[model samples]
Target: MTTDEDELYDADEDPYALALRSGRGPVYLRLVDGRRIRMPVHRWHEQPTVADKTVLERCIGPVLDVGCGPGRMCRALLSRGVFALGVDIAPRAVALTTAQGGLALRRSVFDRLPAERGWKTVLLIDGNIGIGGDPQGLLRRCGGLIAPTGCLVVEVELHDVEERYNARFENLQGQSGPFFPWARLGRRALNSIAADLALSVTDQWSSGDRCFATLAHQGSSFDCPDAGRR
Candidate 1:
């Protein structure tokens, strides 16, 4: 079983090692577009408006940031009048979030989720498309963890699977530097994942040269959040 993620290139570092060592990671402003650059780790906690407004308007109920990092998005949401929570496999990340006056948990999405169905809106942004190996599996797992009316917002690189990661991919990516054969999960892939998870995307947009997708479980027919219902 894939318990912890590490870089095959480093051979002695966790996948998050680069993130922790450099104290920085990329934040894709949009769900697609695919380009991400390593930025200051503080930026992850700053809560930029680029990705925050999109989530604030569409997400319903408490929000969960899967891989919440230093609570950047979480902090942004709180400032926008939305209650947010965070989950990350990196202990340092969890600690950073809590230090920022946010509710965060130190756990992997593979272990156990803190909330039940329709309980909270979960954010799979910031390269969350690669959360659990396969995007489909990741979304499916999210489906089970989401509440009946919960939402799952995702972000992916909007590029070819191979070219994006610049990888040949024998088994899986994760064996090197800033590049890996991570599937971009563009529009087509996003739609398929949403369908597989019994979800329907309600809104999408781009910011800071990034693209994003907002998905939700709305019974059978897809619909937006309403004042009466939510």
Candidate 2:
């Protein structure tokens, strides 16, 4: 079977990696229908924003940041005296994180992660819920990675929509990378998936134009009582 990790091997020549190194974008996620979603590589490389702080404040110690592209969140957490580890399939991303004094590993979330089921919090920000084009499968894997008392902090679409598609990275200079499976889940879709996985949506909130949710094992309180509170 071709695992999710197998699909995400980073190449030195990938346009996304190049963009990360340059700290500039015009990088985009091009869908099969030729529609493009502009990726915020610049924002990712910059300091965490107000919306990002909302997510950051909810994170407890020993946080696992999935698809932690450039590691701004992890770095911010470290500054806050929180233990955070970033995991990414992209080598450049990991290197940047480490360079910024944040600890990171270049590995897929689907792979054998350290301290499985023991993380205090797991993050799926920057539209990473779309990884593998399989939200249910991804969440199921995250479920196993999180401790019983830990919660998943996810950023969902601002509107109600659910989609799965093949996508590739494209740069403004007309360069394109290989296609990969991806998915998008709105709040309702995420709630449905959590219910099916025996998880519950304990909280949902919005920051600016962004939306977020907290999911935990059924009937369990989060490790941090004030998580997601303003």
Candidate 3:
């Protein structure tokens, strides 16, 4: 019943603290400085900002931040009084997340995820669908992370662009960067993935052309007038 993610996030030690000690938190790293690479040194959250006020206001109990590089999202979850834990594949990112007072662990999603069955939310923003370049798998993993009434919140843009290998995207700093191997899922993609995991889209919102959707294990509550729809 327990997974490797459970062991990696044990409460005793801060898994990502060592990375900060080495000071590589500023940007992604390149072992060879080119094509086929190891993995991205995910950008740590720089400043504190509420990306989603309504859903954040509703986060509960323990939270799991998947692909938690340097723990920015995990730290944000904690700010709401949720016992937050950050899970990542990079030792460096693991360090950063813990340095920020979060329970961080260096582990891949392919391994077990932190086992908090009743967690209120599992955050997958920042093109998290790119994990292994499979959106269905990502949502399937998130489904196991949510409590019965809990939600999985994700962000996407209304626009579409060339889908390529090791895709590039602008960071919070507005600097062009490699967000690699991402699968751009639009509204239709979102609905399909949700159903694949047997989850229902409950609420949605949009700003400008960007959109956010909240999926719950409960049936679709896409009744909100402001909820983004096709």
Evaluated against the true structure, the overall lDDT of model 2 is 0.87
Q: What are the Cα lDDT values of the candidates?
A: 0.62, 0.87, 0.58
Better of 2 and 3 by lDDT: 2
Error of 3 at 136 (Å): 0.6
Q: How close is candidate 3 to the true structure, as a TM-score?
A: 0.66
TM-score of each: 0.71, 0.91, 0.66
lDDT of 1 by residue, 1-230 (tens): 43223321243433453454322234221112444444344556455665556556666557778888878777776877888888887676776677778778988777877665654677887666765456777787787777665667777555534222432211113333333334447766787768776688776667665667768775734343533344
Segments of candidate 3 deviating more than 4 angstroms: 1-43, 50-55, 160-181, 208-210, 218-230
Q: Model 2: runs farther than 4 Å from truth?
A: 1-15, 227-230
| Candidate 2: C-alpha RMSD after superposition | 5.8
Tens digits of per-residue lDDT, candidate 2, 67-127, equal 9988999999999999999998888788778877999998999999999999989999999
Descending-TM-score candidate ranking:
2, 1, 3
Model 2 per-residue lDDT at 24: 37
Q: How do the candidates rank by lDDT, highest first?
A: 2, 1, 3
Query: After aligning candidate 1 to the native by TM-score, how far in Å is the CA of 145 from where it should be?
Result: 1.7
